[model samples]
Every structure is written in C-alpha cells, then in structure tokens.
Target chain A: MPEGSMGISNIATCTAPVNIAVIKYWGKRNEELILPINSSLSVTLHQDQLKTTTTIATSRSFQEDRIWLNGKEEDINHPRLQSCLREIRRLARKRRSDGDPGLDSTGLSHKVHICSVNNFPTAAGLASSAAGFACLVHTLARVFGIEAELSAIARQGSGSACRSMYGGFVQWIMGHQDDGKDSLAQQVEPETHWPELRILVLVASAERKPIGSTSGMHTSVETSCLLKHRAEAVVPVRMDGMIEAVQRKDFPAFAELTMKDSNQFHATCLDTYPPIFYLNNVSHQIINLVHQYNNYYGETRVAYTFDAGPNAVIFTLQEHVSEFIQVVRHFFPPETNDGHDFMFPCVVLKAGPGPCVVDDPTQHLLGTDGWPKKTE
Target chain B: MPEGSMGISNIATCTAPVNIAVIKYWGKRNEELILPINSSLSVTLHQDQLKTTTTIATSRSFQEDRIWLNGKEEDINHPRLQSCLREIRRLARKRRSDGDPGLDSTGLSHKVHICSVNNFPTAAGLASSAAGFACLVHTLARVFGIEAELSAIARQGSGSACRSMYGGFVQWIMGHQDDGKDSLAQQVEPETHWPELRILVLVASAERKPIGSTSGMHTSVETSCLLKHRAEAVVPVRMDGMIEAVQRKDFPAFAELTMKDSNQFHATCLDTYPPIFYLNNVSHQIINLVHQYNNYYGETRVAYTFDAGPNAVIFTLQEHVSEFIQVVRHFFPPETNDGHDFMFPCVVLKAGPGPCVVDDPTQHLLGTDGWPKKTE
Candidate 1:
C-alpha cells in the first residue's frame, strides 16, 4: 500500500472555544510542560468576538501527522504545539489500556491530521494558546475515546489554558507542593449565577503587541519583588473580594476589586524590569469618563476594566447597558472618513454553560459502508 | 469717576501649582466648608502642566469686587465663587487685626479686582479647581497679608485645593474630631527630595464635564457603600503605602500604589449611584500597554495613573524617561493633512516647577514709588 493512501482509514476530529484570562496567567515554573506558578481566572467571551475552531482527524491510511491553521498549513514542529500533541497522546495511551468498552468500540487507528483556526489575532495577547490547547486536547480525547475529564488533560497543555477548558466562572487551583500533581480547573459559579451582568468591551486600538507573555513573565519572576508581594500578599485579598462580590451580586464591591485588580496586575507588570505599556491615551480617557459619569449619576452603575491590550472590558447591570452604550456613543462620536468604527467596540454576551461536545462522537472514523469517502 | 479713567491703586499677585492627588480626595462631610472625609496626598507638578496665575488689585475707584478667569470675566454672584471670596475676606480681616505690618502699611484700598488663568483645562479632570481655588486663596493671603496657613483657608475653596498650596509631596489630613478645625494640608515631603522622578502625561481625550467635582462628591456622599469602604478600608492602606514608597525611594512599591490608588479612586467613582465615566479608551489603552510591556520586560520600570479626565499620567525614574518618550512617539506617530495648511496640534511637554512669583510682588504690585498701579 502507498504511504499517503493510509491517511483516510484511521483518525477522528473535534473543535473548541478559546479563553482569555481576566486574572492573567504570567509565569510558568516548568516551561517544557507549560505549568504556571499560580492559579488564574478568565471570562470565556462568546465565540462571535474571538474563538478557535479546530478539527482533528486520524486514519490508518495516513503516512505522517499534519496540521493547518486558518487554512494555511503551519509547521507542526513548533515546540509549543508539539508539546501539546505529545502530552495528549500520552494521556490517550493510558485510557487505551483501561480496556473500557467505549475505547474498544470506536474502531479507531492512529495517524492524525489536525487543523485549527482562530477568529482573532494570534499570539497578540489574546490568549490564542488557550483555545488552541483546549481544542487540541478535546480533539485528541474524542479520537482515542478517552472519557476522563477534559480539563485534566488540558492542564497538561498549559496551566492557564486548563481554566479555558471550562466555561462560566472557572478557577485553576495551583495545588500545594511543586510537582503540580493535583492542579486542575474547576468551575466555581456557573454563567447563570448572575444574569443581569453585561460586559462592554471597548477595543480602543488593536496595534501589534510589543512583547509576549512568555518572556515577560520570565523577566518578572527574576526581577520583581513587587510580583512576589502581589502574588502572595495582594492576590489572596483580591480573590476573597472577588468571590464575595460575585456571590452577593454586589456591583459596587465587584467593580471596585475588578478595577483595582486589573490595575494591580498591570502595576506588577510595570514592576517588571524594563516595564510594559498596555493601556494608551484612548484607554485612559474611557476609564476617566466612566468614573466621572458614574460619580455624576451617584451610584454603583458600571465597572470598567482592561486586560493586556488597549481594550476595555466594562461590566454594568443589564438595566444600564443601554445607558452605557448611549454614553460611549456620544463621547466617542463617529469619525468621518472612517466608517462606523467604535473607539470602544462593546460586546454584550450572557455567559453560557460549561464546554460541552459540539459534535457527535459516535460516528465511524471512515464511511459506514466502507468505501473511500470524504476528507475533513 | 469716568469708568475708562478708573485704575487700581494697589495690587498683590501670587501663583499656585495645580496639584494632582496621588491619593484622591472625594466625598466631603461639610460641603459648605469643603471638609474631606479622609486625608489625601498629591504631587504638585510643574506649573507648565497645570497651574493658576492670578493678579489681585484693589482701588477706591472700583465700585464692586469683580473677577476674571482665563480672560473672560465671571459672574461674582455665582455662589461657589462668592463664598470663596467672602471666606477669604473674613480670614483677611483677622490678619489685619493681628497688626500685620504688611497689611497695615501697604498702600491699598477696598473693592478688589482679580484675574486668573489656568494653564490647563478649566473644568477637566486635571484638577483645575484645585489650582484655581489654591491660587485664589494664596493670592487672597498675599493681598490681605494673612499669616494663617494657606492650606487651611484653601480647603474652604475646595477640599483638595489645600494640597495645591505647597510644592512636592503634600498630605491633606482628614482630622479626627467632628469640628474639622484641624483638617488641613501639610507637607509630607518636598519635590527636591525626589527630583530624579519623571512624569510622562498622555492627554487621552478631553471633554466638557457633564458634572463638576463638587456635585459629583455630593452625589457620592448620598450614595455608594463602596465610597464608605474606600474611605475606611482602602485609602488608609494606600496612604501608608504611598508615603513609604516615596520615603524609601521604592519605585516598585510606589508605582504599584500609585497605579492601584488611581484605579481604586475611579472604581469608587463608578460605584457612585449613577456612575461617572472619567477615563476613555486612550486612558485604558495606556494602562493595558503598560501592563503588556512591563510584563514582557519584568521589573518595576514605569507606573501609570489617571485623573478625572481621559488623560494618562505615567511616572518613572528619570533614566527610563527617554525610552518611554520614544515608545510613546512611535505609537502615536505624527501625521498631517489639510486642503490649504498642515497642522500638527498635539505637542508633548516635559513639565517644570509649579506656579510661582515671576514679577516681584513688591516691585510690580507695590510699584517703585510705593503706590499700587494698574498695569492695564
């Protein structure tokens, strides 16, 4: 039999959503495995704003494994991607030995071809890796017929990336003792817990990122004492504050900590050796306007926060979302020459249930009739 | 007397720097007197960024007290301004009775005419009121030859106004007892103490304020449990952190606290019943970029903050200033186009010392002949 002809008979595929860290994941204690020093949290925005959709297929007919991103085939040799694939295969091997009925019935074989696409910018502080890893893990799990928890396998891909595996409010518990044995993501409060909350994302400007989180976190760990204090002293208080605020549906408390935590996180970033520039002039103006407008209205109405880009993620009650939209429109009036470009591109999404299988996993790897069939 | 022929017989002038609060002051217990609920601290930037230069003169020829701000004469009947003037006068009366030789011997008459100009935006978040009222009180003291502490009197004009009276690090004591008599601005440290520090300000965007600070504070007082918690819980920790950061020359700590305080202050603004929007996208971007860049570099190199306007003010050690400037310039590249002319309007300035006596008060106001004369 020809080498390329073996591709179609063996493999399977799947897709998953990308996640962005609200409480960022900065440092990695173990680089090869991509493990983090502490737990992080993030909001998985709706797929419309940003997401990753990937499909993985395996066949006994295939000669070598292959991959494509955004329709263009990328080098699978990239170390980060390689590590992820290798880890998932190792996990699948363990599941295969369990002798489970589910694993035995898939009639699967092992030459894989994976293709992924990101709806947003790649490696530009948008946490593209989070979605990439989640999808990779999910695809491999489905292919091998491994029924174990998806998050456990995802954690092997990237520490922060694991949290992205689940939806709604998820927490990455950095288990005590450095072997990283028990570290995994757990869903804390579901999306439906707070239905009235709305997020206003202001994409101030999307310019090329000056630096990547990998190198940045390396420098921060080596140089910043402030980082130590923040990770140890401040984060604990903030986490407590966050949990209480979320539980009570206390907008005032939540807004206060959200803004404070965002700034403190960035402050730690600045405390890093050479410094960082996240928020720009337009970003600053939005923060100020929200502050003064809120003060004018005299109540806890809106909370605005910023992540790694010149984008603002503001949370306000559903009742005042229209007001937020109106005020933002008025302040950042439409530009002439330029079509309807918003200084703050507001994304209003109600959180969804945790990640679930989007496609049926019971179908055969090849056509049921056993003819040379379609390719994904 | 012919109105055209009327001229001032005596004039006294003074200048005050605009103070930007490091730990902001908001929510006054006594609105009439502008007594703040908590002690505040600020850095008096160079007069080049923001300051109020005022000229005060009096003559029997003038029928009533009158005032002009930024070239336009304002209605003296406006209660805020009126109260400011009357309060200063009452304090001046006490100074005159104390047998102050400067007041008793100066050749000056009644019916004062004052003119003031704010180098920065009048009502924007740059704290123009702080400089405006501080300049007013300082000039009033000079004219009345009042020996009383300028800060104590400045407080009556605007609570945070007191901090503007001095140069460098200043603290506005919230005072323990209910009478609020002891609540006043006091010098924490002086500017010369940390001359190596550099401030890079990014003017995000400007807006005509929807509500002034006075009204904003009033509304915050009426609502916002977050405001109460901040006054009791957050501010104290920040105040301590700031003072220590400044005293120890700990840039990492200082940067963190400064950034944290700014975000927290704005958060409180959001927590206000109706909510206020003080910052814009530019402001938020500045913050995000700072985080990304700093996280990339790893160590304390720069710190960013925002006032009530959509502007970003960043502080860093003198050494990194050039790099920051270059980065900022690169990000906001200059471009020009027009049908008939080229315009590059936004100019960046490195601030200098705050408002001070340029023409000697005795030489110009008292005149060489020992008689005050109107220059105009």
Candidate 2:
C-alpha cells in the first residue's frame, strides 16, 4: 500500500497504442452496451510513435472520482466514463468473489483520480479515444490488482477501443448474444508476425470538427438501408478475408481490402439520410496519388484508408516506404513558393506490442498528495 | 423535302429539356444495350430555361455522317453515337418492312449532319447528356420519318437519356429481358400533375472536369459492393416510395426520398475503388445550409441532388422557392471581400413537355451546303 499525506492510495501508470481499423466498425447494435453491428479488424500502431499515457490513483480519503484529460479537467459524470469505471470495479469484485487470492481487497471501494495525456496533439485528429480508453482500463486494472480479461470494459467506453486491448493484428468479434459477453477483442497474431509492414499517417489540416462517429453511425443505422445490407452481407466476408490476409502476411490482399473497406464505410456515410462528408480535397488528392503510384508500378504497392476525418492512414511494405514518401512529397511539396510549410504532416510507424505498465517512480503522473503533479 | 446544294434533304430541328434525376441511374447490367441495373425516376426541367436545341439533316448527296456540338465538330465514329445511329436506322427499316405507309423510304439510307447547342453554357456542369442524347434521338426520328417508341433508341445512346424521352415525372424501368427490347422509359405522371413543384439548378463553378458518368459508373460496378447491395435491395423499394410520393404530391416525403437517393448515389461514387469525389467544399456548405434552414423551419421545404458534378439541383414547391433561394443567397454571398464575382450561377425551371419539332425553316442547323452554318 502507498501512503499519501491524507490517506492510503494505490497508483499505477500505463500506456496504450493507437489502433487503426482495416475492416471498420461503423454502427452499434446496442449503443449503451457498445456492441457493434459487424466484426472489425485493426492494426495496433507502435506506442513510441503514438500513444496515450494514463495514471490512475485510488485513495481511501479522496472526495470523489475525477479525470483530467491532456492537462484539462473533464466532466467525470460523462455516461461512457461511468460505464468504464463501473465495469472495471465489477470485474475487480468478481475476481474477489471468485476466490482469486491475488486481488487487492482494500481498493474496491476507493475513489479514483485519473490523469491521461497523449504524446501526440489531440487536435491532430489521430484517433486518441481508442488509446485513451484502453489506457484507462489498463491502468485501472493495475490499480485494483485485477488481471483478468478487460477488453469488454474498454469497449464500454468506445466501440473501437476494444481493438486497442492487444497489439499487432486484433479482431472484435460481433457476437450474437444480447448480453455481449462473447463480443470481445482477440489477437489474431503477435506483433512479430509481420516485420515488414509499415503504416504512415497523413494528418490533414482539418478546419472544422467532424461529426462524431457515435452520432454519425446512429443516423446510419436508423436511416441508411445500404448500411444495414453492408452490416448483414458485406462485412462478414470482409472480416474473414482480412483475417486471412493478416495471417498469411499477404500485403497486396491486405492493402486492397483495407482501401475497399474504408471506401465502403465512407459510402455508408454518404448513404446516411442527411449524408456526411468526411474526406476533403487533400484526402482525395492523397487517394488519387496512391492509386496513380500503384498503377504506375503495374501493381498495388500501397493502400490508403480514412476514418471520420480527412487524415489518411496508408499501409505498405517497408521496401516501398521511401519511394512512396518521395512520391507524396513530390506532389504535395512541403515548402510552398513563399517558403511556408504547406504539406500534410505525416507520422511513419510499425506494428507494436500491447499496453505496458510503467514501474519507474519518476514517470508517475500522480504525486504523494493523491493528485496530479504540477508540470512546467 | 428541302433541297441542299448537292441533293434533296430532310431536316428537323427540335429541343429537349435537361432531366435531373431525383433517383439516379448509375450502373448498367448490359453496357452495350445501356440497360441499367436499377429503375430510376427524374424530373424534366422546362426547356425554355435549359435545353439542347439539335438540328439534324439527312441528305442523299452528303459525303459522310458528321456531328458538330456547340460550334465544334466532333467525331461521328464514337461508339455510342454509332449505337444510336444504327438503332434509329434499324427501327426505320423495321417500320418500312412492316409496310407503315407514313414512313419516308427515300431517306432510309441517307447520311446525316447533326448540329447541337445548349441554351445555357455547356461548362456549367449541369447534366447535358440527358437532354443532348434525348434531343438527338428525337430529332433523328423526325428526319428519318419514323414515329414509334424512341426511348429504347435513346437508351442505346445513354442510360439516363431514356428517362428524358418523356416529360414530367418519368421512370426508366430496369426490365429483365436479356435483349433489352423491353427496357423502356414510361411516364408516371404528365408535366401538369405537380403544378407547384419547381427545380433550381445551383451551378457550382467547376474548377476541373469531373469523371464522366460512363467511366465513373463502370468503375463503381466493378469495385463497389455497396452499390451492388443498393441496386439489388435498396433502390426497388425507393422507386415505389418515390412514385407514391409524387402521385400523392406529398412534398416532405418526396423531398426526403429525393435527398436520400441522391446521397446514396454519391455514396456509391465514394464507394468506388479509387473513390470518386463529386461534391466539394461549396457543395458541402450548400448541403449544410439547406439542412439548417429546414431544421429552423421545422419542416422540409427544399431538397437537393447532384449528378457527376458539384452543382446542386434543388427540388422545392413554388411557394417556398423564393424563400429557399433567398436562404441560398444569404449563405453563399455573391460578392466576396475582394470584389470578385464569386456567386454560384443559378437557373430556375419547372417540369415541361418532351422534345418537340420546330416547323420554322429558319431554325434549321445546316444551310444549303448540307453543313452547319458558321456562327459569330
């Protein structure tokens, strides 16, 4: 047990990687339960390049549970946040009740203070929520001394967050049960399975905030008949195909399916009653450039996928990375005629391991006062 | 009979209105026959505001068949052009063989000189093909002295052009016949059915030529699985609902379905492999403004649709036309801060009649030389 000035507290620090979906999860069957309409697959990106660092501290004398995201305090009463917190506590209590000897019985009733920050700028529009929730669940599990499966708890925060539970290739099985107990993230393969695979994120300069995936998908489910058909017919085959592509280390097959799935997802967005526009001119240009580059080589050497924003995540092999990057730079020159930097910012990353626990004392986000430490 | 410099010729001048698809015709099941994968519905705009005036002459002494579009001579050897010309001749031959006494047998094997022009600027990005092909087929029928269902012939020129063969609310039935002989356009209601309905073409200033519908739909059919689902499952039901909406003159229901179908069409475009982008920032802004205006009024007053371009074709009742147009002008200010005329040009029109011949001799495109006269 750790002692704060006011009372006894347990603290844990952990970090999670951002996962980019190839076969995307669009609509939720159960909004409250966060159960998706179809199975989804993703590639967990390297934590060193992009990650969320979360510090969780549970104290006996704390006033209440609170959370500060990226140096700014947020509403702790947000329903999704409550869902994650409640699920994690329930799991901890279940472990104790099941006669798990390793359970820390003291922290079960304690209030928690969470400090979460991303290494990358949140404004960059790289999916921070997946990493945020995954880190929250991982750190909370460590603080409570509960080590059982926690992907379901992470999913209660965000539908896509469940895929971030494991590194390398992961799949979220859309189970049929109403209770959603079987709908959990499973690792298809380890990080070392595909050493040559590379991911490059082209961060577009977004002018306005796009519609949230939650509300956008809600509209799709309610109004888009195309979406319903895709969920029922198209995705099951795609889920199987993507899993096979990952297992076989088939780069071209994987790339083609990624791009197609991304296109179909945006298609569903357009099919929504009011329609949604996610990709902008830059994103369009990037897509064209990728295809043109691949066509020039007489084969598909690169693939691009977009989420709910203009940014594009490209999948390619290590051998083609340098040439592809050069091609991108050539078309969208970094320096404009007036010497201003006008190019889209890009981050190159590779497949990496899952969430990690930080054992170093100096890296702790919470101080002895059971509160976040002041930083310069 | 009219006498050219070399020989006698039969000449006919006609004009056809541009029909905007509320329910779009996208993919084709039989490319050669121009048979669509799904049924489509459209509203024909008044020819007085926007139309293609085409003059065709069949002369015995003409050297070869030729066509001039908007003052520029184009190759008559284009396959679609050949398809139209062959189909018209075949129909005329069939009529003659059947001993139709009204047929002009003398002009059966004569060569044709075609000159077509639009009342509005061709660069405005409004769909010219629908009206252009419809007028061509209609005029050719008159010049050849054959009076039969010519929508089938026009369909061989372009799929959507078949729908333009009729006025007011028309539907191109995606018939199941393998030979495409039964695939034809039918009028759901005459132009006078909906007196208060109006169409406004918000011609967006296109910076570059968009992908032609021919190649665009080709790519969509080959790549987009969502399109497959839409054509198979979604569109059939939409066609029924839209026809009912139009028959009942239910403005709100009609508006909702029109907007949704248009969105789904563009969504299919996005679902294309390389992903075609027809809507731009200006198009997006207009969509937002329309929705925001409708939400403010607590009713659907206006609905919008787009073809293979950024221009928005709005469907609204005559009572709300002025207000909607005012709302449009307010959101997209005509004058920019720099005093440049950046306003999106608009053309207001209503449902009108089908192609009609001009009996006035001065309206003929070709002069005595059996060729198009030079225009200043």
- Give the fraction of true interface contacts kept by model 2: 0.88
Winner by TM-score: 2
lDDT of each: 0.66, 0.87
lDDT of 1 by residue, B163-190 (tens): 8888888889888756667888888778
Give, for candidate 2 chain B, the lowest lDDT window spanning 10 residues. Answer: B336-345
Q: DockQ for each of the predicted structures, in order?
A: 0.09, 0.62
Q: Compute the lDDT of residue B317 as modeled in candidate 2.
A: 89
Docking class of 1: incorrect
Q: Give me candidate 1's TM-score against the actual structure.
A: 0.63
Error of 2 at B14 (Å): 1.5
Error of 1 at B151 (Å): 1.0
How big is the positional error of residue B290 in model 1, measured in Å on the Cα after superposition? 10
Minimum summed lDDT over a 10-residue window in model 2 chain A is located at A336-345
Candidate 1 per-residue C-alpha lDDT over A1-376 given as tens digits, one digit per residue, 9 for 90 to 100: 1235433443444445555455556666676656666666665555656666666666665566777777677787877677667766766667667655555533244556776667777754456777778877877776666666767567766566687777776777666656566677877677778888776667665565566666778877775555665566556666666767777878888787666666655655655554554655566567777777778888768877666666778878889998888898888876741322357554676555444454553432234322223554
TM-scores for every candidate against the unseen true structure: 0.63, 0.95
